[model samples]
Target: MLDDITELNENTTFVEEAKTIDEEDLYPFPTSEDEPTTKRFLGMTPAQLFVISIEFFFMVLIFGVFFMIVTERMTIPF
Candidate 1:
C-alpha cells in the first residue's frame, strides 16, 4: 500500500555513497558520483524564505508576549 502511494507521488530514491578524505593526503576532493548535484532549497525560493522568516519571527514575538503576560499575572498580588 505504501509503495503504491509513493509511486503515485512520483517519489524516487537514490543510493548515497560515503567518501573518506585525510588532511595529510593531497587529493581530498569529493568525487562527483558521491557528491549529488541537487538544489535542496529549490522549493524554498528567496521570497519564500523571507516570508517564512517573517512568519517565524512574528510567531516567536507573539509567544514571547504571551509568556511575559502570564508571568506578570502570576507575579502580581491578588
Candidate 2:
C-alpha cells in the first residue's frame, strides 16, 4: 500500500476541481407549455405510482409465500 501511494503521489494529474450543484440544475425531462397537464391523484406523481406498483408486487409475493407455508406446513402432524 505504501509503494502504491508513493507511485500515485509521483503522478501529477490526481487532483481535480470538484463540481458543485446549483439551484439551476434541472431534471432532463421535457415539458411543453401548450399541452394540458393532467392533475396528480392525491398529489401523487407518476414516479410515486410506479413505486407503489413495485411495493404491491412485493407484498403479493410475500403474502403468497406466507399463505403457502400456512396451508402446506400446518398440515404436518406434530
lDDT of each: 0.63, 0.65
- Residue-wise C-alpha lDDT for candidate 1, range 1-78, written one tens digit per residue: 234544543343332111233443555676666665665475676789899999999999989878877888534445
What's model 2's overall lDDT?
0.65
Show the colliding residue pairs in model 2.
none
Q: Write the per-residue lDDT of candidate 2 for residues 1-78, one digit (tens) a residue.
A: 234654564434433211333324543454575445887776789999999999999999989878877889535356
Question: Model 1 Cα displacement at 42 (Å)?
Answer: 6.4
List pairs with backbone clashes in candidate 1: none
Residue 76 error, candidate 1, Å: 12
- RMSD to the true structure for each prediction, in A, is 16.6, 13.4
Candidate 2 ranges with C-alpha deviation above 4 Å: 1-37, 73-78
Provide the clashing-pair count of each candidate structure: 0, 0
